[model samples]
Target: MGSLGSRIQGSSRGAEEASEGSCAGTGHGCDCRKRKRSSPCQCDSEAEEEDSLLNTPRRKKLKSTSKYIYQTLFLNGENSDIQICALGQEWNLHKVYLCQSGYFSSMFSGSWKESSMTTIELEIPDQNIDTEALQVAFGSLYRDDVLIKPSRVISILAAACMLQLDGLIQQCGETMKETISVKTVCSYYSSAGMYGLDSVTKKCLEWLLNNLMTHQNVELMKELGVAVMEQLVQSSDLFVMQVEMDVYTALKKWMFLQLCPSWNGPIKQLLNDADSWICKRRTELGEEEAFLSTEQGAPFTPVFRQVRLQYIINDLASARILERDNILPHDWLSAVYKLQWFAMLRTEHDNDTGPQEANKEEFDLNSMRCGRKLAKDGDYCWRWTGFNFGFDLLVTYTNRFIVFKRNTLSQPCGGSVSLQPRRHIAYRLRLASFDSSGKLVCSRSTGYQLLTLEKDQEYVVMNLDSRLLAFPLYVCCNFLYTSPASGRRADAPEPESSAHSVS
Candidate 1:
């Protein structure tokens, strides 16, 4: 029985070896089968064991595959009792990695874990903290169609900077700059200065100063105007100072002209001094000054004259008031007319005479009506009728149905007529065939009545058939008659009358 059992075991081992050799693609001389029976199977068994271990669970494979390591930061000295539970009820604490603090010593943290989940929690001491509520607040801030206040933007910027959120910091900075006004910019300057954010402070200051210079005005600049000026002066910011100083000088000149016209000499002197100071300062700082200079080599003569004329007009207008009911003084009228002439001359170079000379002729022609002979050197001869009767002296270039009238004092001339160059007719004159008298009369024409003049009064009338003719008059001193054959229809409506005197 013992021999039979040994034979059977040997037979079984041989059968196993034969099967292994066949599997190795060798009948009986395979090296795997020739190796020691124990070790030969042990190698295959160890490899199978490893394969089974690899296929056992995917969690171990994932752990071995992932090589990323996250760094953690504890902000605000780590005394913060940051509650992990506040992140979310579903937050798994096993995967948490990174954290940071809020700006105001408040506890805030962010964590990342497996399954592609991230959790953020904020802890404010002495306050009821709700993660959803905090999220809603931030969501409202970033939501479209929400009008976010500038203050809120500033707060967000501060918080984003503290959290090391570079993209959020940049976004908030741009928004703050866009909505910040000069007043708010000033306030922000103070706040940013206190925060040791030198870069942010500098950028904000630049924007504020630029905006202030753009809209530089007395009323607007009055708030912190002195401070702004001092800063520009001390910093030697020539461009900013130039803009501000130009606006300041213009406003000063305007106010002075409006408020003190009688003190012309003093005002002019002050303006010159200020202008000189600006020029000198500009030259010292290597900047170009734009102002009128009496010195040599100045290139802006026209601009200087324009500015001077403007000042003169402003002064004159400020000093005088036009009263619709009160009569203007003769001297004041002459002065105003003179100023107007000067303004015209400055604006237009077509006139050869000065404003005073032009105004003298205009005033004399308007004051009284009289005829003057054309001299050999004169350009044109002027013939006018004297002022008399309720109907003043009206003159026209030629005879037309329409008549020109002027306002005059009442007269006693009922029949007497005055002619140019001292010819006075006591009887009314009439028009007959355009002749000097009734010599070439074609037919008898009806004539209008004329007013009789007293000894010192003057009346004008046309003489034809020795009848006086009067018609409605217009106030235009200079008139051009339009002929009926020249497409001028008498039946057409007249133009609207103007209030200005004609000259």
Candidate 2:
């Protein structure tokens, strides 16, 4: 019995080996070598061997936690429990992910009707919120990070704000802050204000303050509204070119563009065209009253009020331009003239040597803003026009150093210089250089400081690195040569009008 069992086992083992070898075509038991390559027997053997190579399944990498959730849950909507209908589109969303949003969380958790409903319809009233924005806003709930283009930030911000997605809103603010430029600054400012993003709003304002005069653009001017212009004009930080008169000129061009948005012309001709347009309008209206007093110019009265007429009227040529343009009311210029006369008398006789202390409030609101553009790296010595309370300030850029000299006697100056033993002036010095796209390449500021200078005294305000200096650099300085004892000059009258200006 034992011998018979051994024989059977041996026979079974041989049979198994023979079958394996025949299928593999690697043993004498196989006849595939003699068969034609295209024959079914050889093909079958080859197929068996090929199938064996891939018999074990390939192992695929698992999706990441965030990606898996975003794809399977947000995009694919594989196991969605809620249907969101908005902007003529539908989203199969999960309540767990929807709970991440304050808007949806409130609807689902509160006693609202949507809490019990499977299909909820959303009403979107914000024009900035569109379907594409909604898609990004929704996908953000399922993903760890989102890619937002600067162009689409406004719309996404609107959607995120509507949906009360704090994270997405913050991300949008960061993106807007990082991408601020001449083109998007105005829109971003308005949108940031609308969306309650004060940081972005402040960032936009800084960009505008730095570039408004340094890099003037016709389109940017057209986009600036009255409120924004008022803030910029009133700010002591405004970078003025040459003198206060240029600021007025820029405002004139900006106002003209604001009125005539369709007028597309080169920047060099903007001033001439604006002047011609105003002249024609004055002729057509047949009125000698200042444009700000008329119905057409009344809307811009606030913006014009922010202009330091006292500084502009100090220059004879600037005063003549103001009178000729008739854009400002006669009463406005008359009051400024009277104020200047009194200021001049005080400075000349009363021994008033500018501000005694640094009153930042007084300096910011009333400082004389002036700037100069350095076309190249070289020695530059110049002074802005107009009498600055006998503080004839001279700015010098030499050897990569900016020096301020109280021009009392060292050099011959066009304007009168104070001979006081000591004079105090609160000033903020800002230097900036821009690229071709009007983006700041390098910048520095002295913030706001009070400096004391005696006759012929010189102070080095800035020491710059030669390598950091760029051509066409702009140097903006705000100087407060005088500050009131307390409140605004009580004698100076505040004017009010009851009309609107369109142009």
TM-scores for all predictions:
0.24, 0.82
Return the clash pairs for model 2, or none. Answer: 296-501, 296-502, 298-501, 299-501
The sequence of per-residue lDDT tens digits that candidate 2 reaches over residues 370-457 is: 8899998899999899867778788899999999998877646545666768888888998889876566888889998988888888
lDDT of each: 0.34, 0.85
TM-score, candidate number 1:
0.24
Question: 325-412, model 1: which lDDT tens digit per residue?
Answer: 1112234434544644443332222211111112322322212211121112212212233212112334332332222233233345
Q: RMSD for all candidates, in order, please.
A: 32.6, 13.3
How displaced is residue 84 in candidate 2, in Å? 1.1
